[model samples]
Target: MSTMTVRMNEQDAELVRKFAQFEGVTISDFARTAILEKIEDSYDLQELREAIAQDSGERFSIDEVLTELD
Candidate 1:
Protein backbone atom coordinates (compact mmCIF):
# COMPACT_ATOMS: atom_id res chain seq x y z
CA MET A 1 0.00 0.00 0.00
CA SER A 2 1.16 3.54 -0.74
CA THR A 3 0.30 6.71 1.09
CA MET A 4 -0.47 9.99 -0.70
CA THR A 5 -1.17 13.41 0.73
CA VAL A 6 -3.42 16.13 -0.60
CA ARG A 7 -3.65 19.81 0.31
CA MET A 8 -7.00 21.51 0.70
CA ASN A 9 -8.48 24.60 2.35
CA GLU A 10 -9.76 24.08 5.90
CA GLN A 11 -13.38 24.56 4.77
CA ASP A 12 -13.06 21.93 2.07
CA ALA A 13 -11.26 19.57 4.44
CA GLU A 14 -14.01 19.95 7.02
CA LEU A 15 -16.66 19.29 4.42
CA VAL A 16 -14.89 16.11 3.32
CA ARG A 17 -14.52 14.95 6.91
CA LYS A 18 -18.20 15.58 7.70
CA PHE A 19 -19.39 13.94 4.52
CA ALA A 20 -17.18 10.91 5.16
CA GLN A 21 -18.55 10.61 8.67
CA PHE A 22 -22.09 10.87 7.37
CA GLU A 23 -21.36 8.09 4.87
CA GLY A 24 -19.83 5.90 7.62
CA VAL A 25 -16.43 5.76 5.88
CA THR A 26 -13.05 7.11 6.84
CA ILE A 27 -11.87 10.21 4.98
CA SER A 28 -9.15 8.22 3.24
CA ASP A 29 -11.58 5.57 2.02
CA PHE A 30 -14.04 8.20 0.82
CA ALA A 31 -11.35 10.07 -1.07
CA ARG A 32 -9.91 6.90 -2.59
CA THR A 33 -13.28 5.69 -3.85
CA ALA A 34 -14.20 9.10 -5.22
CA ILE A 35 -10.90 9.50 -7.05
CA LEU A 36 -10.95 5.99 -8.50
CA GLU A 37 -14.57 6.43 -9.63
CA LYS A 38 -13.66 9.70 -11.35
CA ILE A 39 -10.84 7.99 -13.22
CA GLU A 40 -13.09 5.14 -14.29
CA ASP A 41 -15.75 7.58 -15.52
CA SER A 42 -13.19 9.51 -17.56
CA TYR A 43 -11.83 6.33 -19.14
CA ASP A 44 -15.34 5.15 -20.00
CA LEU A 45 -16.18 8.50 -21.61
CA GLN A 46 -13.02 8.45 -23.70
CA GLU A 47 -13.75 4.92 -24.91
CA LEU A 48 -17.29 5.95 -25.84
CA ARG A 49 -15.98 8.91 -27.83
CA GLU A 50 -13.49 6.74 -29.70
CA ALA A 51 -16.19 4.15 -30.48
CA ILE A 52 -18.48 6.87 -31.77
CA ALA A 53 -15.73 8.27 -34.00
CA GLN A 54 -15.03 4.81 -35.46
CA ASP A 55 -18.73 3.91 -35.87
CA SER A 56 -19.92 3.04 -39.39
CA GLY A 57 -23.50 4.25 -38.69
CA GLU A 58 -24.96 0.83 -39.52
CA ARG A 59 -28.56 0.31 -38.43
CA PHE A 60 -30.17 -2.92 -37.20
CA SER A 61 -33.25 -4.08 -35.33
CA ILE A 62 -33.95 -7.24 -33.36
CA ASP A 63 -36.66 -8.27 -35.84
CA GLU A 64 -34.38 -7.75 -38.81
CA VAL A 65 -31.64 -9.78 -37.22
CA LEU A 66 -34.07 -12.62 -36.41
CA THR A 67 -35.46 -12.60 -39.92
CA GLU A 68 -31.98 -12.78 -41.36
CA LEU A 69 -31.17 -15.70 -39.09
CA ASP A 70 -34.32 -17.63 -40.15
Candidate 2:
Protein backbone atom coordinates (compact mmCIF):
# COMPACT_ATOMS: atom_id res chain seq x y z
CA MET A 1 0.00 0.00 0.00
CA SER A 2 1.05 3.59 -0.65
CA THR A 3 -0.10 7.04 0.43
CA MET A 4 0.10 10.38 -1.30
CA THR A 5 -0.97 13.93 -0.64
CA VAL A 6 -3.28 15.92 -2.90
CA ARG A 7 -4.25 19.55 -2.68
CA MET A 8 -7.44 20.86 -4.26
CA ASN A 9 -9.26 24.13 -4.48
CA GLU A 10 -11.97 24.31 -1.82
CA GLN A 11 -14.88 24.39 -4.27
CA ASP A 12 -13.54 21.56 -6.38
CA ALA A 13 -12.91 19.52 -3.27
CA GLU A 14 -16.47 20.05 -2.08
CA LEU A 15 -17.89 19.04 -5.43
CA VAL A 16 -15.79 15.90 -5.40
CA ARG A 17 -17.04 15.13 -1.92
CA LYS A 18 -20.65 15.55 -3.06
CA PHE A 19 -20.13 13.44 -6.13
CA ALA A 20 -18.38 10.78 -4.07
CA GLN A 21 -21.30 10.73 -1.65
CA PHE A 22 -23.73 10.33 -4.52
CA GLU A 23 -21.66 7.44 -5.87
CA GLY A 24 -21.32 5.82 -2.43
CA VAL A 25 -17.55 6.09 -2.32
CA THR A 26 -14.99 8.09 -0.41
CA ILE A 27 -13.69 11.27 -1.97
CA SER A 28 -10.24 9.67 -2.24
CA ASP A 29 -11.61 6.65 -4.10
CA PHE A 30 -13.48 8.91 -6.50
CA ALA A 31 -10.35 10.89 -7.22
CA ARG A 32 -8.30 7.72 -7.67
CA THR A 33 -10.84 6.30 -10.12
CA ALA A 34 -10.93 9.56 -12.10
CA ILE A 35 -7.13 9.69 -12.29
CA LEU A 36 -6.90 6.03 -13.30
CA GLU A 37 -9.48 6.55 -16.06
CA LYS A 38 -7.46 9.43 -17.52
CA ILE A 39 -4.30 7.31 -17.41
CA GLU A 40 -6.10 4.46 -19.20
CA ASP A 41 -7.34 6.85 -21.91
CA SER A 42 -3.83 8.15 -22.53
CA TYR A 43 -2.43 4.63 -22.57
CA ASP A 44 -5.03 3.58 -25.16
CA LEU A 45 -4.13 6.57 -27.33
CA GLN A 46 -0.44 5.64 -27.13
CA GLU A 47 -1.21 2.07 -28.15
CA LEU A 48 -3.29 3.30 -31.09
CA ARG A 49 -0.42 5.51 -32.21
CA GLU A 50 1.99 2.58 -32.06
CA ALA A 51 -0.40 0.45 -34.14
CA ILE A 52 -0.70 3.21 -36.72
CA ALA A 53 3.09 3.54 -36.88
CA GLN A 54 3.28 -0.18 -37.68
CA ASP A 55 0.76 0.15 -40.55
CA SER A 56 1.80 -0.60 -44.11
CA GLY A 57 0.94 2.92 -45.46
CA GLU A 58 -2.80 2.28 -45.81
CA ARG A 59 -4.68 4.88 -43.84
CA PHE A 60 -8.31 5.75 -43.20
CA SER A 61 -9.48 9.24 -44.08
CA ILE A 62 -11.45 11.30 -41.58
CA ASP A 63 -14.45 11.03 -43.87
CA GLU A 64 -14.20 7.26 -43.82
CA VAL A 65 -14.15 7.16 -40.04
CA LEU A 66 -16.95 9.72 -39.71
CA THR A 67 -19.20 8.26 -42.37
CA GLU A 68 -20.67 5.78 -39.94
CA LEU A 69 -21.79 8.62 -37.67
CA ASP A 70 -24.03 10.11 -40.31
Candidate 3:
Protein backbone atom coordinates (compact mmCIF):
# COMPACT_ATOMS: atom_id res chain seq x y z
CA MET A 1 0.00 0.00 0.00
CA SER A 2 1.08 3.59 -0.56
CA THR A 3 0.27 6.86 1.14
CA MET A 4 -0.56 10.22 -0.34
CA THR A 5 -1.10 13.59 1.32
CA VAL A 6 -3.85 16.03 0.36
CA ARG A 7 -4.33 19.53 1.71
CA MET A 8 -7.63 21.40 1.62
CA ASN A 9 -9.08 24.57 3.03
CA GLU A 10 -10.59 24.25 6.51
CA GLN A 11 -14.13 24.72 5.17
CA ASP A 12 -13.78 21.98 2.58
CA ALA A 13 -12.11 19.74 5.15
CA GLU A 14 -14.94 20.28 7.58
CA LEU A 15 -17.49 19.41 4.90
CA VAL A 16 -15.70 16.18 4.07
CA ARG A 17 -15.38 15.28 7.76
CA LYS A 18 -19.06 15.90 8.34
CA PHE A 19 -20.10 13.83 5.33
CA ALA A 20 -17.80 11.01 6.35
CA GLN A 21 -19.19 11.01 9.85
CA PHE A 22 -22.73 10.98 8.50
CA GLU A 23 -21.90 7.99 6.23
CA GLY A 24 -20.20 6.12 9.13
CA VAL A 25 -16.84 6.00 7.37
CA THR A 26 -13.41 7.42 8.06
CA ILE A 27 -12.57 10.51 6.01
CA SER A 28 -9.94 8.56 4.09
CA ASP A 29 -12.35 5.77 3.19
CA PHE A 30 -14.98 8.21 2.01
CA ALA A 31 -12.49 10.10 -0.09
CA ARG A 32 -11.07 6.92 -1.58
CA THR A 33 -14.49 5.62 -2.61
CA ALA A 34 -15.46 9.01 -4.05
CA ILE A 35 -12.25 9.19 -6.07
CA LEU A 36 -12.68 5.69 -7.49
CA GLU A 37 -16.29 6.36 -8.52
CA LYS A 38 -15.24 9.59 -10.26
CA ILE A 39 -12.49 7.81 -12.16
CA GLU A 40 -14.89 5.09 -13.30
CA ASP A 41 -17.39 7.71 -14.46
CA SER A 42 -14.73 9.47 -16.52
CA TYR A 43 -13.72 6.22 -18.23
CA ASP A 44 -17.35 5.37 -19.00
CA LEU A 45 -17.89 8.81 -20.53
CA GLN A 46 -14.80 8.46 -22.70
CA GLU A 47 -15.93 5.08 -23.98
CA LEU A 48 -19.38 6.47 -24.81
CA ARG A 49 -17.84 9.42 -26.67
CA GLU A 50 -15.63 7.08 -28.72
CA ALA A 51 -18.57 4.87 -29.63
CA ILE A 52 -20.67 7.84 -30.70
CA ALA A 53 -17.83 9.26 -32.77
CA GLN A 54 -17.43 5.89 -34.51
CA ASP A 55 -21.14 5.75 -35.45
CA SER A 56 -21.67 4.14 -38.87
CA GLY A 57 -25.24 5.40 -39.31
CA GLU A 58 -26.67 2.02 -38.31
CA ARG A 59 -30.06 2.57 -36.72
CA PHE A 60 -32.40 0.39 -34.70
CA SER A 61 -35.82 0.75 -33.17
CA ILE A 62 -37.31 -0.89 -30.07
CA ASP A 63 -39.66 -3.02 -32.17
CA GLU A 64 -36.78 -4.22 -34.32
CA VAL A 65 -34.85 -5.32 -31.24
CA LEU A 66 -37.85 -7.11 -29.75
CA THR A 67 -38.65 -8.85 -33.04
CA GLU A 68 -35.11 -10.04 -33.39
CA LEU A 69 -35.14 -11.36 -29.83
CA ASP A 70 -38.38 -13.19 -30.48
Model-by-model lDDT, in order? 0.99, 0.91, 0.95
lDDT of 3 by residue, 1-70 (tens): 8887889999999999999999999988998999999999999999999999999999999999999999
**RMSD to the native, candidate 2?**
6.2
RMSD of each predicted structure = 2.0, 6.2, 1.1
Q: Write candidate 1's Cα lDDT for 13-70 as tens digits.
A: 9999999999999999999999999999999999999999999999899999999999
For lDDT, the strongest prediction is 1
Candidate 1 clash figure, as a count: 0
Best by the TM-score measure = 3
After TM-score superposition, what is the CA distance of residue 14 in candidate 3 from its true location, in Å? Answer: 0.3
TM-score of each: 0.84, 0.70, 0.88
Query: C-alpha displacement of 58 in model 1, angstroms?
Result: 1.2
lDDT computed for candidate 1: 0.99
- Residue 39, candidate 2: Cα error in Å is 1.4
